[model samples]
Target: MDEAGLSRRGLLGLAIGAGAAGLAVGAGAGTAAGVAVGRAREREDAESAYAFFGAHQAGITTPVQDHLHFAAFDMMARTTRDDLVSLLQDWSYAASRMTQGLEVSATGAVDGSPEAPPDDTGEALGLPASGLTITFGFGPTLFETVEGEDRYAIAALRPRALERLPAFLGDDLDPAASGGDLCIQVCADDPQVAVHAIRNLSRIAFGRARIRWSQLGFGRTSRTTAAQSTPRNLFGYKDGTANILANDAASLDEHVWVAASDEPAWLAGGTYLVARKVAMLIETWDRVRLSEQDAIIGRSKGEGAPLSGGTEYTEPDFATTDANGAPAIDPNSHVRLAHPEHNGGIRILRRGYNYVDGNNELGRLAAGLFFLSFQRTPESFIRLQRSLSTDLMAEYIRHVGSGVWAIPPGARDGSFVGAGLFA
Candidate 1:
């Protein structure tokens, strides 16, 4: 433990306890030599990697990695169940090896016969595992389409919670990017490591499936555990200062993990993943006055404290009024509307990332938060988003891309991913 009576990993959480907590800049590790040594140990640890076999997938509760490569794919027309199963089996084998920093195949890279193409892409050949985790999910369409066609003959297996997301206010969804038959979320501390995982997985998918769309992101916007510091969004405010921590077993069981009782037993220990590509109007926001910006977010830009309160973590005095009789924390502020107190004590585990994908036609930076959240049911996200419809931050952002997928329970050592679906 540190001098503060908190473990080295608890610094960020301590800040949250302080209220008005967001992120602590430069909080962990010390000195160049110390950082170097720490990183070396981390590299060794990363090489061993998180086990791909578990009761639940790793990335959902794992500490949010620094980089992300999220992809959604659609099975090719006429793709058979056998073809899909084969693809899943191959992917499972490859993922198990790659997570341990091994090449995807024994004939990996240059080891494959010269007469044949290399098995692994080889970009990550010399890299450590870098804490890479790849999680896969199935979309509603994967079970049955909106037209009521059971394309995959697995419609009966679909969870009642896996239906299509209802159109929400201010959604400018792009159909090409909004839905997918399958989704893969690859996250890692190393950008190359994350990308490499997706690249090879796409290769394995080959004829069975094709990429519908993908998003690249960096700088995680939330911490999944007390071990991590809260990160900032492109808006420069601390994002998810009071987010659900991985160590909060009670919260995980209640809000994030799917129970056998939730139905469709194949997803018992799994969860639902909702992805939203929220494009922030950065230029407009930058031009706004600082005080106005703080008002919009309901937190001080500098301290991240509730406008109504003492510290960032201070329970917002929602009933407090100003001298003129206006509510202290604006009723429309992002934080006020999204807070669990106002939303029936509902909360979602956020694991979003900041992204910049060049400039738009008007030359404004095409950047925003790639909002990702895992919950026991899609209703959780829907409820939160519906409450945010009146949020002050809404005008400054647009939801352009979106998806919802039912992540299956993790595969055991001898089984392939999603093997239960087939069974």
Candidate 2:
């Protein structure tokens, strides 16, 4: 948060230019130097190598990228506290370089001696960063495993709000795709870039940790900035039409970021992340009547306007009724149930994506919404989810995988993410 609006952790969408003096990149961080040079290579690219050109935006609120590769990891059994710390340090260093459009290290991919293995995976060699952002999170299991083993000895430092999400009404959660000790969310415009990030980071994790479960997503279902239009979900309805925009500082502070006055002093400025893998019954939903579909969601299929009347951005007038005097929006409609007006003014910043994992044995597309949301406290999500238990739309979807994590604040130059927990 410097005067030029460049904070290493905050500006994932924009690389700081050559004039950023006193940058604390480590030895051989030609990575940072290369980023500055790469942007200046062309005047037009220099103008907009990443989103927003030169704005002070954090990764969570950065304009939503087109693809996502999210992976959750479990620390290896018997690994000590030092192993965890070193793993994070290595990850932070690698993430910092990769986001700047460089390889995992200064002598990465192919620059090394032929006698040795290259430092990078090499698939993304010719690609730009693609506006990449790698965000890390620590799950409740990271603090203490199910067997009560506190391998990292940092369990005491875990935030009170960082716990597993309670099972919702329609949850059919699969253990294989559920919990993790740590998670990394990689987003970029190119699907390969997103895949490359997870591949390289997983290679870096080698033995200290391993991916417990992973998901690949495309066609983002939400937008984080006003410049971007709302996207549609697999249900063919506009999603995230009322998302918390990056410019909404008031809502961000009140509903997304953790405050200094909150408990677990180490996590100030950080936020809570909730991820749910919602599987849709596409065939069943398609067979339903069109008007019935609109009624279930409480929004117009095309314009995404509230059924109660007005455009996408217009606030719904839930009290409005039809010619017969029935409620314009069904009490069981999704929009009404999840709206802040119904949930004590609660809202979560969504950064979800539509996912299709090929076809299943029955020939139905194995697809769903990989839902990701950030909130100041887990309760914001919990309350809204509780209210959605009666949603009519719930009949066509199932929650199959779920997790919650404590997102640490942005790291400073020369510091690894979550450095405060160790302190």
**Candidate number with greatest TM-score:** 1
After superposition, which runs of candidate 2 have C-alpha atoms over 4 Å from their true positions?
Answer: 1-58
The candidate that wins on lDDT is 1
Model 1 agreement with the true structure over 1-423: per-residue lDDT tens digits: 122221123433443443332223343323333435445555554554888888888898898888999999999888888988998889888998888888999989999899989999898877778788999999999898777877767889998999889989989999987889999999987788889999999999999999999999999999988878768899989889878888899998999999878788889899999999999999999999998899899888887788887876677888988788998889999988999998888889999999999999999999999999999999999999999989999989999999999999999988988889889
lDDT (10s digit) by residue, model 2, range 1-423: 122222222233344433243255454354466455444433322122342111222458888988899999999988998999999899988888888778999889999988998999898776667778888899999998888878888988889888888878999999999989999988887678789989999999998999999999999999999899999999999999999998999999999988899978878878888999999999999999989999999999999999999899999999999999999989999999999998899989999999998988999988999999999999999999999999999999999999999988887778888888999
Global fold similarity of model 2 (TM-score): 0.88
- The segments of candidate 1 whose C-alpha lies over 4 angstroms from its true place after superposition are 1-48
Q: Model 1: how large is the Cα RMSD against the reference?
A: 7.6
lDDT of model 1 at position 55: 89
The lDDT for every candidate, in the order shown, is 0.86, 0.85
